[model samples]
Target: MGRVVTLGEIMLRLSTDSGVRIAQADNFCAHYGGGEANVAISLANFGHDVYFASKIPDGLGEGVVKHLNRYGVHTNFLLKGGSRLGTYYVEAGIGERAANVIYDRAGSSFAEMTESEWQKEELFNNVDIFHISGITPALSSSWKKTTISLIEAAKEAGCKISFDINYRGKLWSQKEAGETISEILPLVDYCSAGKLDALYLLGIPEATEQENELVYYYQEIRKKFPAISVLYSTKRTVVSASCNELIGTLWMDDHYYESQNHVINPIVDRVGAGDAFSGGVLHGILAQKSPQEMIDFATAASALKHTIHGDCNQFSEPEVNSFLLAGSGKINR
Candidate 1:
């Protein structure tokens, strides 16, 4: 297994029960999650040597460390400092009612962390893959610089960089995200972005009506950022708040590969499915799987994630493979 590193915030997630609106909830189920942290957990479940790097409030951070350890993610690089860990709220949806997320993460420990706080030299030691997302840079001006530096340092340490353009409109504007992400793309090896990101963030022009829109955008992206060896995204059709049709796509070796559609009904939770997909793809890459295999595995992992209640994909690699072989809703016995 490869040694992987993921850097970002690990937040406390307080979510309401299904059909309970945030305002009406007197009780909530608390879980711990964040974009990069979620990815770390997934990679760990896949049997990779994964380390998560970030800071959290000293006392309150114990639970966070235990959570990561429970999932097999190493917390050696996790620093304990700052005033508070980040927290967010989720209102679970039912049927056609969509879920909602409220970010109360401003001034959190990870956001306030400085470059000097990290043990940079030791952090990247023998790391094979480094994963991060756009969300870290969106936190603060200081974080933006730190994110870029971390990427550069990882690259110098011979780690393949996997970047997910996990854009959050709540955190930063399109113009700002666009500018920041553009700066980071040239350093990225594997990228996760969709049509909207291509058009809005990367500033790729709209494809002609006759052209395959997503392919055109990806081609344009490759032309502009040649360092990106792999580009991937998902096509999701929302049937309702509880049902979705998802397809994973990959662009590699000058070819576009797609996974079969997965029709997910009665989704238990959808918050971390994308991160799960990203983790699957990274795992596939590390395992040297073919493009088609990678996408298939990734899509299946994502589908399984929708059945779980928390923001982390709890399924292991063998479980994901079993799901692929048996398909959904079949009795194992």
Candidate 2:
């Protein structure tokens, strides 16, 4: 199995049932999720060896590690006892709407973690791919420094690096974020972006549907990050709260390949669909699937995720392939 290492904060997630606002809800379901960690979990479920590195409070952190281990993810790199787990509240939408999140991550163990807490050599040693996200760098200035160090070490170790520009507006301002992400664009092997994220980083306004926008958008982004090997975008058209159509396209070696759209009529939970798509694409790269097939499988995997709750990491390979082949079926493997 290929060894993948992910570095980021893992937060405790609380979501109210029946679509009640956080202030109105008396209780909520709790789970664990963080972008890089979620991607690592998805990869592990596909049978790839994966590890997640982050700092957490002792008991709560141990619980997170044990949960990750249950999914076959290596948790040895997880550090504990710095502080409490970061948390967020989710209020899922009903009918024709989208979900919302309220992050309560400040002062959490991960946000307070020191650069000394990360043992770069041991974490990246013999690793096939190193994954990171914009979320970590947005946490604090210390995390920004930590992220830079981690990327430098991974680059020196000759590991493939994948970055997701998961811009959280609530975490930081646009100018500061644009400047920071632009600085690191040259250092990554693969970069993922949403339409808004691309426009935000490239300084382009959202395009009108009539403009054949992807072409122009691609040119601007590629010009900005000439060193990036693969630039992927997850395009989604939210038709309704229950229905959305998603597609995957990549700007690779000066060319772009657009894949088919996977439609979901009743999206159960849209949280981690993009991460699942990235996981599928990464898996396809390791399995040597063609670019088109990679997008296909990735799109299919992501579409399937809407039928499941929490994050897409809970899905297995066979389950995704079943949806790919059978159109629809029980999600369990």
Compute each candidate's TM-score over C-alphas: 0.98, 0.93
Off by over 4 Å in 2: 204-211, 329-333
Model 1 per-residue lDDT tens digits across residues 1-333: 899999999999999999788899999999999999999999999999999998989887999999999999999989888899899999988787889999998788888876747767798999999999999999988989999999999999999999999999999999999999999999999999899999999998988884567888889999999999999999999999999999999999999999999999989999999999999999999999999999999999999999999999999999999999998899887
Worst 10 residues of 1 by lDDT: 112-121
Question: How many clashes in each candidate?
Answer: 0, 0
CA shift of 136, model 1, Å: 0.1
Error of 2 at 289 (Å): 1.3
Please give, for residues 1-333, the per-residue lDDT of candidate 2 as tens digits: 688998888888898875687789988988888888888888998889899888889877877987788888888888877668888888988776568889888889889876757667887899889999898899888778788888989989988889888888899888888888888878888888756777776586776673567766776777777767777877888888778888788766677778777778787888888888788877877777777777778788788778877864677888777777776544444
- Candidate 1, residue 126: how far the Cα is off, in Å: 1.0
Query: How much RMSD separates candidate 1 from the native structure?
Result: 0.9
lDDT of each: 0.93, 0.81
Q: Candidate 1 regions off by >4 Å?
A: none
